[model samples]
Target: MRVLGVDPGLTRCGVGVIESGRAREIACLGVGVVRTPSTDELADRLMAVAEGVEGWMDAHRPEVVAVERVFSQQNVRTVMGTAQVSGIVALAAARRDLPVAFHTPSAVKAAISGSGRADKRQVTTMITKILGLESPPKPADAADALALAVCHLWRAPMSDRIAEAEAKAAQLARNHRARLADAARERGSTGGQQR
Candidate 1:
């Protein structure tokens, strides 16, 4: 599966594409950051981000998109910008009918590293090692996007299985209800004929 991970921010939103093979091997197809000028109008800045995200989506044609969940920061403005960028990311993917997943920072850290409390350095180091890159991806945002992609790839199989199981259970319930209804109809028909 190919996944596009987005680490959204107003100034520098990071985007990464990663493909995972059935054998669990992973490859980094691309990684980059989209920068919007702080001086630009809010609407223009958001448009730039939307265009950037759309370009990645077109280039990668990812099977799924993963975005970092926005967390409350001390700076309300910063959080608001991040949330706005995140919404743009999701909207871009939604336009193409691609599935989107949101992962918390801690969840991403735990998926890449061993601990949820891992620092940025540790997360970057683990991502570099996992991708077999000689150096870590620059600008923590890029690394974070890569981590989100990897995390989704790693968890997607289990998620798929769970979804399949739920679907199957729903089908069985539907079938059972149909059988019961059919039986009731048959019995009613036979009783009316006798009457």
Candidate 2:
């Protein structure tokens, strides 16, 4: 599976593309940061971000997009910008009909490292080892994006299975309800004939 991981920030959104093999090996296809100047107007910045993300999607053609779920921070403005950037990333994926998955920071850390509370350095180090990179991806944001992709790669199989099971259960329930309705209709018709 090919995944594009997005660590969305207004000033520097990170984008990473990775391919997961059947043997559970992860290969980093690409990694980069999309920078928008703080001096730019909010609308321009957003547009730049949208274009940057869309360009990545077009270039990599990833099957899935994994985005970092925005968490509330003390800085409301920062959180809001992050949320907006994340939305743009998701929208870009949605435009291509790609599946999008949101992974929490803690979840990414836990999946890449052993602990949910692992620090940035630890996560980066582990990511480097996992991908057999000579060095950690420059900028913590880029590494985070890679981690988000890896997390989704690891989790998607089980997640897909669970979704399939739920769908099957729902279908069975619907069929059962249809049968019950049919039986009720037959009983009602017979009762009406006796009137």
Candidate 3:
């Protein structure tokens, strides 16, 4: 599967694209940061970021998008900016009818580096090894974006199974509810007629 991963930030949102192959082979197609001028107004910065992300989506044409889930930070302004960029990524994906997956930083780190608490260097090193890259992907944000994509690729099969199970359970519950309603209706009709 081809996936686009996003590490969202107002000033420097990271975008990366990768493709998965047989036997867990993964290839990085592209990785980079999308920057917006901090001096610009919030609305303009958002627009720039949106356009930058859209450009990546257009260029890569990924089947799905994986975004870093915004976690609580001491800096509310920073968190807000991250959340807004993340939303832009989701909206852009939705416009193309693509599936979007949000994975937390800990989850991405764990998936790539085998530890939820792995630091950026560990993640970058592991990502380099996983992708067989000569060197680590530049910029922690870019590496993080790649990690998000990798995490989604790794998790997607299980997610699909879980979704299927949930759907089946929901259908069974609906069917059971319908049967109970039908039985109640039959009882109501028969009892009213007898009365």
Candidate 4:
């Protein structure tokens, strides 16, 4: 399955594409960052981000999109920008009817480096080894995006199973409730006929 990971930022939103294969083989299709001029108007900047994300979607045609969840930060402005870009990425995926999964930064780090507190360099190093790249992807954002992609690829199977199990459990509960309701109604009707 092909997956696209997005690390959204107003200045430099990161994008990465990866394909998962047999026996968990992973391939990096692409990794890059979308740069928008800070000096530009917010609307224009958002449009730029939207266009950039849309272009990646069209080019990669990923089956699902993995996005970094925006967490609370000391800088409110930074968080706002990240959230805005994140919305744009989600919108793009929604337009394509592709599933969008938001993963926490720590989850991505742990998935790639086996540590939730792994630094950017550590995550990048792990990504390099995982994809067998000669050199690390430039800019932390790019590596982060790749990490998100890898995290999704690794987690998706288990997530699907969990979802299926939950659905089945819900269906069983509904069926059980329906049967109980039918039994109660039958008892009530027989009691009324006896009156």
The TM-scores, one per candidate, come to 0.84, 0.85, 0.85, 0.87
Question: What does the lDDT read for residue 54 in candidate 4?
Answer: 92
Better of 2 and 4 by lDDT: 4
* Per-residue C-alpha lDDT of model 4 across residues 114-194, encoded as one tens digit per residue: 899999899999999998888999898999999999999988888989999999999999999999999999999999999
lDDT of 1: 0.92
- Judged by whole-model lDDT over C-alpha atoms, candidate 3 comes out at 0.94
lDDT of each residue in 10-55, candidate 3, tens digit only: 9899998999988989999999999998999999999999999999
Residue pairs in collision within model 3: none
Question: How many clashing pairs per prediction, in order?
Answer: 0, 0, 0, 0
Best by TM-score: 4
Candidate 3 residue 167 Cα shift, in angstroms, is: 5.1
Error of 4 at 101 (Å): 0.9
Candidate with the larger TM-score of 2 and 4: 4
TM-score of 3: 0.85
lDDT of each: 0.92, 0.93, 0.94, 0.94
Worst 10 residues of 3 by lDDT: 69-78
Displacement of the residue 29 alpha carbon in candidate 4, Å = 0.5
List the candidate 2 regions with Cα displacement exceeding 4 Å.
Answer: 165-195
